[model samples]
Target chain A: MKRSSISSFSNPAVIAELAAHLHRNNVASIHIEAADGELKLVAPVGASLQTTHRATPVLISASQPGSLLAKAPTAGIFAAAHPLRPEREISTGSAVAKGDIVAFVKVGPVLVPVIAEKAGKVVSVTSETGTLVGYGTSLFTAKT
Target chain B: MIHVLGCGPLNTIQDLGRAGYRNIGVTATGAMDPIALKVGNLLVGNDEDAAGIEIQTFPFRIEFEQAQVFALTGADCAARLDGQDLPPWWCIRAEPGQVLELSTPMKSARAYLCLQGGIDVPLVMGSRSTSLRGSFGGHEGRPLAVGDILPVMAGTTISPPVNGFGIVPPAQAMPNLFPVSDTGDLILRAIPAGEHDLFGDDSERFWSQTWKITSQSDRTGYRLSGAPLQLSAPVELRSYGIIPGIVQVPPGGEPIIQMSDANTAGGYPKMAGVIDGDLWRLGQARIGSKISFRQSSLTEALAVERAIDAYIDDIRRTLPLVANALVAMTKR
Candidate 1:
């Protein structure tokens, strides 16, 4: 099998053309190697190959290096503190331990706590109070 | 199962109180604040009227014998579990042998503790409330004491981890709908009762003057001290059915407002009855707290009841969805 190299096709238009060809040929998945990077595309179930990229699926491991992003455990309105109490809002740079309630997601009258899964120092809070957040969306970032 | 390590003032098991037995002279004998009890039970996925602990004193403590879910409602007693503070009205799970302690309430007088199913107690006269007078129901018909062991209703099915959710307590000492006096006394809405007109000039003073809850008050009745309220003339009457919130005046001229554990029937002249909607406010009223009464139309009284019902309806509709969502999230 001849290896396909996409180093010469630095323009995005060329990549789009190649993706269109793969779609026409009914290819489900394909990997292209470039001079500085690689692109991998897998067609979604019951669909043809795409021309644009979807969200990059991230695999989070506790041992992963650098800053760790804390994501929403569920979908709801994010609350930096207790809903009835605005003064208890969690601030940036606070120390958090495993299973500590750092924030909440309010659904109706119920507040689901966004607990820390590992001990770390909070670096930033990305979600605003009362803002809607989807599951796995980055809510905050912390350094272990 | 749970063990009572210490009880500060008074702790009694209460539900919505017994009904129908009043015809035979049985007091309802339930929670001083039924709204608190109902909200606490609903938070733990229990029936709204399920039995729970009504803590009247402060610094109460209990230890869970097994891991279970529970909720605290009513007064903000500043509760802590295993040394970590819990927000009032939040439902949290307890690990085995974890101690839950309650300090003096900051806002209201009573606090309720509701378990997932409820506090397991045999119903007496259709309720699990403790009848202090009758002494026949609720943990041997008396207040919970130290070293007492209470059984919790067994969980029917494993529920989702409902660890963080809470609602605002419905009991407000000062609600905006009613008038509040300059002295910060709560103004409870009232309607004319059977002998309302018999009080003559006293009726006018009842609505105008602020009354202080005397130290003699308890679950049975609140002895109010203010301007003396006397009847137009001495009248003899047979004992009649009396419910909670009925304002009765004895010869001493001091008006007494009936409570949850009030006598089923009384011979005192009933001057006015507090509206059902404002009864919860009375329940949260502490000794020395002052209150004034407002003459409200029956229509207005009905409106207050409707608002309370609607608030409860909102909770009933939303709590189940919250519970389900929690379960689904945990499964993931």
Candidate 2:
């Protein structure tokens, strides 16, 4: 099977596969952007497809008022917790302080922490564990 | 510099090890878990062969005399920096006067602490590793003690994230490569040695039965207890060169796997030699743990080595990128 990239989202087959993966993994949403365009897919609770749109790429999005996102600093795999640690660093409704590591982006053998820019309560963890994430991909949505 | 506040005997400084002098009867004494030491060194931007502290006995406590960047790898010792819990396989900067404590690990054996500049122990026989038997290398050629002050080599300073970062431990990252028995015994891959066929049926038994690591085990070798392995016929043999991981069965019919501090030569009947790539896992195996052997080929052994090399290469290539990205992000 061919690997999917941001550019491949224009293909219907790739989009369908990605949506199926999102539903299978129970992911809340995925927002991807490249120089050419952007693709946003939101799978609501128990729903396969709630919203799918193509819009101007916004590097950082404040989906909810006063809610900040912890974005991926580089492109890599998303890990909710350090692979060696049994406990997740942050989850929905968890309180986090500024500079707290809410998640990690694993670029091959290296693990880069996704730090919370501001102290807030995590409203949602947008990225699925073990999924590929791009630079500026929202990992956690937190409200001050 | 760092001051050893509390420590147990046998914790010493080690690099990759002193090589080539084994023929002259000098044992190659190095960190039991060499992979951990290498990874720890790399994490702190040191050469892979840079010297570091190998802590097997704990609780080890030290006070950093100056602000230093360090990395801790290997066994999850539940380390704490000034009362803050640090993750295993992690690297961070320790402020001057900050205390770092490491408790006994719940699982696995040995933990490594590598500083940005590496340990400044005088190299004897071309390595910083302590030759406990020879008593000439490392921090005065003996294990560290309380009040011992060790110097650090000067190196270029590189900033890590405030809280530091960690890599996925090799055991967790490459679980499928090494096999574990159904009963939770470690399965080590080995190649048949010079006298393997001499044991006849016992050689097969050696591969089949699970052996328990006896308490007599040390850095020199592991004395395994299992069903006594006997040879088809008794034969006299001349002493021959030996290396780490050589499984030899003495007249007592028990197997002893030579380790990092292995003797230069031995006269015992050889059964098999564990692959070098899996020696790190054996190094981490605790006394009383069970282990089994799986016959492997040279091809398979090289494959395992390549896999390990790939892991290290990945870390070397990505660490700087991640660090640079984090620095850029924080500056924004």
Candidate 3:
């Protein structure tokens, strides 16, 4: 559902400021859903994002056949790869084994690995690196 | 419990080290790279000063006799668990009977293997570190040998996600502070010691020339081979109390930098004392590695110490937050 009325009033600078605050504090992402509209801001993961925050309402759809959505196990900053091993980052089209560490959710100084639920090819990475994410946030869409 | 299936000589159990006993003629024998041990312990939910296995000689191999959590830090020894490659500075859980092996490292010289709750060695003189010189602490007062079964203390368990996680090594995380020389020599910061003036013009050579760590080096001290640092004249000085990091010049004129297992007293002339903050880098320096000294002031030394303290403080403050958060998250 498109809320054109509320979308017209969202200020770009306000969103940028919020995103900057999240990055400065090492937070992953924030989501606010109200009766009028929804505002979601995520920090960049691997590389710096050209656009700091995403304010547009996301489209929610049913899972397609053979597709599996890997959700975040807890809330924290999402990392595409371990901080020390960036070259092994999991990306779209990367083949992953069941129980493989496709990414990480960093809480403070500790990094909690984000595991692959099943062996599959990553169809898409829904979460951006360095962005704040909440528990159960869909991080990757993969095809088994 | 873990059984040492294979190990090299000199690999020993060490903690932060024994303090206040150097007066009684006991060397503060401990991990050469103490920072690595502390970080490894912190990663495994152990106290910063917890005892761990400091593995220098390799290929060291061990088998987990029981399920346990462990963290590997310091030198990247290309460790593997049941043939699965693990990154350096990583923490993970191992199932019973899982074999963990470490190969000779290509870069850094020592690797610390810290288990959850630390190694259950009897604390001798207020620490669990082995006093190899005195042969009184750690596992039977000697280095770890094959078939040595070390008991790990019971610790509060926290769940880590499958495949585990790792942190950026301090060398990479805190770069550009005390940088390496452009010529690829390890740069060590030092404060002029008592006998520094005696070297006269030779003191300049000590600072300018890159010294190679000779084969005679060990935990006690690194005998550097470079231009002879002859003093203005021969002067006999009485033997006095000494500690690690003191740069002493003996009759041979080559400088010797004291280390973890340094003798309690020495009679040689002192040139410069390496700053404590940079000692870990020196600890990991391999034999044949080139190193040069950069003169530093007390203010600069304190500043560097503060930066290292901040790094450790960050880990101490944030580890509990992460553990608690993970426990709550897993419960859901």
Candidate 4:
């Protein structure tokens, strides 16, 4: 098939020069393969704006269809460990059983333990330590 | 009963001063800071006027002869129970063998350790307070010494083990309670006494200048260093009854404020009287520290007294709730 859009740039020298310019600008892919083909270019999003879509859900794991997301049980300051034992932190891949204190939330001077709901390996810690978190905010992702 | 392992030279057992006895000749030798004694008593669930140990020296050591619930108030003495640090103004349970060591206070001049009940010394003249001059009451009318074992009152109720709370001293809880000087001098509120006019210009100077607390001050009286206050003339005055807080300017240029152990009567020209509410600040005043006078009224003094009462009432009301809450939390 032939078209005027691609035909206008039919010269091999002009086409090569256009491709070189696009490549220098870090464009990922370009298509002008056919005489009638519309020119198209794609570039990876900048690192600062890597994830621009809000509706894209994060998958905890590919192998597990129902990977567990550990959420805050109550609204308070999310602490990775007890306030008294601040040096201790919940490590990723650490095994936790049901009712085990995987993390804590500090309410004033009192520490409230966040118990695990199911036996699992911590896939990732989602909440930053000492940050105020609301109820149901993701604290960790675990694979049971 | 508790055994004194070590104590400062001035440590003694005290309660609220002996009431209705100044008519005789007995000085009401009691805790310099009566509010501290009262608060410590309340923390441990005792009568506000319960006799307790008043520690003025550093490294005061005591061993519990029996399991008891006790509270420490007043100064932050850096207390340690068997090497573990104890919070000031806190109530804690002590096992029979636990030794509590109270070092010199970091910010105050005295500390009060009160047991669950009042001290069990024989009440003389209807009070358990020590009469240092009469040598009649409170652990044989002498300061507590090593090897001196004080028996706590029998059947004194032991508070719950979970009871743990502290109170900020009234003077510290509100900055406005006792006005502090810019130079850090403790400015005590005083009411001009009967002889205040006798000093004339010196009276004005007394209210304006900062007076240094001299080393000669003791429980009986605080000798102050300032301009020599002179009477309008050398007048012979009859010996009259005096109470704590009376500022007596004696021979020479210094002023003297009577304390908990002061003589019941005096003949010195009294320029002012430190109000009952602010005497505790003078109690905590260390030697070499400076003090200023703030002229106050009786109505204002009564208000400060009410404020202190309200503070104690708050602690009394909130402590049980806190204890119950702590117990519930621990069980979960």
Top DockQ model: 2
- List TM-score per model, in order: 0.79, 0.86, 0.82, 0.70
Task: Provide the lDDT at A52 for model 1.
Answer: 35
Chain A TM-score values, per prediction: 0.52, 0.57, 0.56, 0.50
Clashing pairs in 3: A28-A131, A28-A132, A29-A132, A29-A133, A43-A130, A43-A131, A44-A129, A44-A130, A45-A129, A45-A130
Best by TM-score: 2
The Cα error of candidate 1 at residue B45, in Å, is 1.7
* Candidate 2 per-residue lDDT over residues B1-332, each given as its tens digit: 99999999889899999998988999988889889998898898999999999998999999999999999999999899998878789999999999999999988888999999999988888999998888889999899999999999987555788988888888778988878888888899999999999999889999999999999998899999988999899978899998989999999999999998888888999999999999999999999999999999999999999999999988876677667655644443
lDDT (Cα, tens digit) per residue for candidate 3, span A16-50 = 45556776776666666555544455554432344
Q: Enumerate the candidates' DockQ scores in order.
A: 0.14, 0.25, 0.22, 0.01
Least accurate stretch of 10 residues (summed lDDT) in model 4 chain B?
B323-332
**Residue B46 of candidate 1: its Cα lDDT?**
82
TM-score of 1: 0.79
Per-residue lDDT of A31 in model 3:
67
Determine the TM-score of chain B of model 1: 0.95
Residue B255, model 3: Cα distance from true site in angstroms: 1.5
In terms of lDDT, the best-performing candidate is 2
A30-61 in candidate 2: lDDT tens per residue?
Answer: 77766544556544445433343222223444
Instruction: Between candidates 1 and 3, name the one with more favorable TM-score.
Output: 3
In Å, what is the interface RMSD of model 4?
Answer: 21.5
Candidate 4, residues A1-144, lDDT tens digits: the string is 235554354232343455456546755444444433343323232212233422222232234323554655433456786333345567687887775557755333223456567888888786677565443445776887
